[model samples]
Target: MSFIRKRRSLVLTSTLALSILFLSLIAVMVGLLYKEQKNAAFHGFTEIGAKLSAQAQVSSNLIASVAGAYENKQNPQAELVSSLQLQLNAMIDDDNLTNAYYMSTKQFEIDGQPNLITMIQSSLSSEGSNDNGTDYPLDDVFLDGYHRVMTGETLLTHAYSDDIGTWISYLAPIKDDQGNIVAMFGLDYDYDQVKRELSALLWGVIGIGMLAAAVAIGILFFIIRATVRPLGMLAVAAQEAAQGNLTISMPVTSSDEIGRAAASFNDMIHSLRQLTSSIKQTSDEVTVSSLNLKEFANQSSQATQEITIAIQTVASSAEAQFSSSQETQRAMTEMAIGIQRITESSAIVSDLALHTSERASEGEQALRDTVHQMNSIQTGVLHATDTMQELQLASGKVDDILTLITEVAGQTNLLALNASIEAARAGEHGKGFAVVAQEIRKLAERSRESSDEIRTILQAIKEKTAAASAVLEGSAEEARTGTELVQTTGSSIQSILASIKQVSDLVQDVSAACQQMSAGSEQIAATMVEQEQIAKRSSTNSHHVAAASEEQLASVEEVSGASEQLRVMASKLGEAVSRFVI
Candidate 1:
């Protein structure tokens, strides 16, 4: 087994198996034909023996008389003997079925079997070939048959070798008028001649059988080639499909099983093609949505950053205004103290006090006017501050929207990633889909990056705004102190001190209002930072709106399915993220 090569094919196997079977059938046929022919030759010998015995029986009287005449030294009828010889001569010819014939008288038994001596042989006839008469012992080679024939039974012998050649002999007994078996007639057929005939017949049969086997084997190969070649092609096509090449299709050439199978394969390829198309389309949609969401989030972030920067600028300006107001309040406090002492002196001197009172009255009116003017400035600053606070709050709201956009982008990215995984599982055929998924993922990442940059800028603005707000708080505290001093001065120096004090109060109020506005702006800016961060995050995964968007965002689940529920994206990042965030 180890020494032999083990290569096998359908054609080889089929041809080998059938060849063995056909050869075996032919062998059986030849064996049977040969056996039958041999049997037929032996049967012919028996028939000839019987015929000779019949003739002998019909001339029993002549045979008996001839034997009696030879025994008594008298001549039996020559014409009768000659006529019998002539009849026997005809059967002895080379072309005749029987090779030789003889009459033999049974004498004695050896080993319980009768032996014989040939009495009248057919060799003296013109066509005769054998001359062993009276001396040739017939029973040696034909023991079984001769013994049986002497007992009044006809018998045939298998082929045996004699002095002349191999022969099959048949022996029949001849009976006298008294029914006593006197002699036996023997007929012989040449075994060699029969064998030659059988050989010729066998050769003819073999020639035809071999030719038929050759034709059959050729046909077997042709059938296998026709059938198996198509099947092999189908196999190759199937392999391509297995490798994820759904583009391959088999051609149906017939209505046979192979053809039907090919048709089915083509159908399968078509279905797979459609399925891949759907998946690819879904991925493409997700990519577009993410990109759009990213862009929207980025814009919102940038706007928020700008607003935060503007608020920071306003806070810095307010800080400067508050500083100046505090300086003015300090000057007013010093002057107001001076006016109080002066008012004390005026009370002591009458005429001086009268003039002083006149000046004081004018000063009182001027102080009142100054104070009112300062109040108006304070009111204006307060409104400005309030407006700044509202703007910050609005910015925070805008940040919230940005956050939403970021989330949409991030989700779209995730969906694209999932689609890529599925494509990988599908193998080489899914290479195109995988590429789409990669593009989508890249787009999402870009969205996330943009959102991050904007969020950073917003954070920086928030920090600056907070710092400005701190400075404003210090300024506001100083303003409150200066305002208290202004009130005290107004009570003491009713005219002069009052006017200075009122002016100081007005300045202080404006400073305080500006400080409040600055603080509010800072808080608003901080809130905007938080909102922007949220928005950026939202934008980051917002692309894959399928799962999280729709339910989390709404219909982020379906993107649509293969749609099979393509939710992996339907918030599919919310209708391709509002079709470019228009």
Candidate 2:
């Protein structure tokens, strides 16, 4: 295949491959990001649930402790219940609990008054059949626990939902001196808070993930266009040069991979130009040699025809010479001189062919050297392409790591949220824990942001690496085709050399025969002038043959010089291409 076509193929294939790789990286990053978001969401939900559960437990414990304090009769009725209720209400008000309440099964009065207890009873009755006349479910668990308190049974049921919210209701039975329950107390937590926090966190993470993805895609697109496009241009240029179109120039004008590739392409073009020029020069010389050979052959054919006519004349003379033998001998001697001249011309042709063969051998050696250098360049390009591929793979791995980091950040955020909820529920006692929760959440946010940055950077690296790989692959393929062309030229030179060698051997044999012919032609007086003329013609042909040989030698030298220059240029191109490492 022609170098140009191979180079174009390489360019197209490399471009497509790079594009695919870049897209794949983006897809992998996006997938990883999505997974991280999902993990974060789940983790956030779990943490939120656990925090809520912890807060609820702590609240429940506080309610039980306060209830125990109230039952101990540490002070008077109004003072203890009123102060205790106020404090318990304050606790619930300050935290995330659904409700906190304490009620007595006995006649508990406000402000140290008896009739007030009756009024309170009447109020409770008016509100509901359970807690006065209220429609809301009002259970006097203290009344139910009256007998259980003596049995030391404090009922704590599983969490449930009420008008207030989902809650874990704790029942701590308070007993009198008579071992009868007097009051019951508990608090209800706002269980929905966990779900609310989880929802909020989920949305936050999703928003960040979308933003990151958008940024990454944008960056990748920019990088691919900026970097890959130039590389493609360089590849095209290289292809053109390889095809013997040395005027091709790369459009990429940057200091990056594209720029380097373009420069290398230019260098390769220069080399190819020199190589082609040499080959053309050699071919021109060969053409001139062929013309010389054709002229020599025509001359020899004419001389042979003249000799044949002269022989006919001599034979006729010989038949007529029964009357005069001298005339027959004279004609015969002239014909022999003509034959000697023809033999000498043939000898000159043989010498020219020998010189041509030697020149061809030299050309063949130069072509072989050029092919070897091109092969080395091809090998270097292949290695460079492999290195670029490895870089792209490494970039992919970095993207994966970013995804993992993002996921962990999300989980950490969830944990912080849960801790926050727990601290809220803990009220004044949980204040220190709330600060820790806040810090953790901040750290998570930072981590998420960092992962996003990493993903963006990795995406850029992936794009650049992919582009580099594409350019390298294209260059390698072009070099391979170039090597093949060089090899082909080398083979052609060898063939020409072999043909020349045969011609040279024929010429040497003809030279020996011509000497014998000249010696045999010496005795005929009438043929003497003809013999000298043939020798002169032979000498002129030999001079022309020598001139052609000199031209062939000069052409061969030009080819060798061009081939050497090509080798140097290819080496320079390979060196320039190597600059993109890393």
Candidate 3:
């Protein structure tokens, strides 16, 4: 059953068994005492009867004279009976013999067998007996004593019962002048009085035994209750512990086993409480980590999407740049052909020289258009460079965030390590917690590794973006040089028109300037091609970075999920431990 009940039962059973054993022992001792007292009382009565019988021997002469008179058919004088009664009366004492008398035996026939008759008796009798001579019963014990007395032997009866009362009779033989046995003197003691005393003693012993049993029962009850009381408290404490209330304190009243067990129980509860508190703290940390990781994952995902869009824009810009470079090359080829035609006309006629001036004007206008296009290309390159710089800044910020994440992961790992150590210190009870700590440590390591990967990708993106910016700047400078060359070509064209009257000398110069403009256009096209290739590479790197970011984000999400699970597990553990009151 319940612990308290079992304890109480055990104690009660032990007490009862002991009490029964004690009572039985006391009963045996009392019975023996009563038997001894009974024997002593019987012995005392026998002694008193023998003493009175000896005292009656003093009247032996008178008793023999009376017997002689009675045997001759002569009535004994009243004075002899009176004298015998007076002497016997002197022997009679209070609380001793009940009767003392003398009797003379005579031969008679009974059923064809010889028998003895009492011819004379003392006049004295106990207050309860008849004074007149009366025949005594011929029982075996009485006859044996009487015969022994007739043979001059002193005898005591073995206590007999009759109509008058229970008694022990003692007999002493009366002798004649010739020393022959003629009569017996007897004394009877009241055995009934001894029986009453013994009965009283027996009752007293019974009363004492009953009192002892009662006292024993009371003492046993007190002892059992005192012993069981502590156990009851312990049982209550255990019940409270079972109900998850560890706050109970037991009183250590003694250095007994129960007290020691209570102390140990309290210690256990305290330890469990500490472990629970640690688990709760760890759970809170894990929850915070999960939230932070989730937020970081979302931010990283957004950053990657932004990077993807930026890369797509850069790719578009690079494609436009490639197409623009091709157009510039085509325009340069067309300008070279026009320059060849102008050179051919210059050798043909001076009258054709006006037409040559008009062609030169048109060529100057084309050169101005080329300058404007080059300026526009320079502006686009600068704008793309600025955009790339902004993307690089963003990547730098992401790197910083990753660094922070790595630091957090490291801190979390340290915390997990500390927790694991504490769990190890807690021994077997904390094995589950140690496993949880190990899992948390693993998650933290994974997080740190993921952060490292993200940092690496950001570093690559930063390098690629820087390279792309430098290329864009170089391309812008080349475009500016091309614009200046186109402006110089336009200026040379104006001067050639002013000197068209002496056009033949300036023809070679004009051809050389056209070739220079063509070379500059080719250089500009080469620069644009280089810028486009750089932009394409930058776009590819950005795409790689974006993909890596996505992967890192996924890893972060996994870490976050793991952290969340860890948090939940810790919470469950805490809740489980919380069932204890402590």
lDDT of each: 0.50, 0.48, 0.58
Compare the candidates by TM-score and give the number of the best one: 2
TM-score of candidate 1 versus the correct structure, residues matched by position: 0.48
Across 1-582, the per-residue lDDT of candidate 1 in tens digits comes to 211122126546756766676677678867886897677556545655665567657767666665555445465577765655555554453532454444555355556656455545565432445343344444466877766776778887777886767777777776788997765666677778888888997898778767766776666656544544554565455444444455667778897444554565565455445533433443454344334433332333333344333333324454432342333234323323332332232222223223334544543444344344334434544454555556566657766766777778767876785576556547788899989998998998798667745653453344333323332333333333333433443443343333323323332332333233233334433433433345443222222221211221111111111122222332332332122111
In candidate 2, what are the lDDT values of residues 83-190, reduced to their tens digit?
Answer: 444444333433344354444433443354321011011122123232311112333433343334335565444446545466544445444455454444444444
Model 1 lDDT-worst window of ten? 552-561
TM-score of each prediction: 0.48, 0.50, 0.44
lDDT of 3 by residue, 452-481 (tens): 656645654564466456545755664565
Between candidates 1 and 2, which one is better according to lDDT?
Answer: 1
Off by over 4 Å in 3: 1-33, 50-91, 102-134, 140-159, 170-185, 204-227, 250-279, 287-565
Worst 10 residues of 2 by lDDT: 115-124
Q: Show where candidate 2 strays beyond 4 Å.
A: 1-32, 54-325, 328-340, 389-437, 512-516, 519-582
Instruction: Give the better candidate number (1 or 3) by TM-score.
Output: 1
**lDDT value, residue 233 of candidate 3:** 66
lDDT of 1 at 107: 58
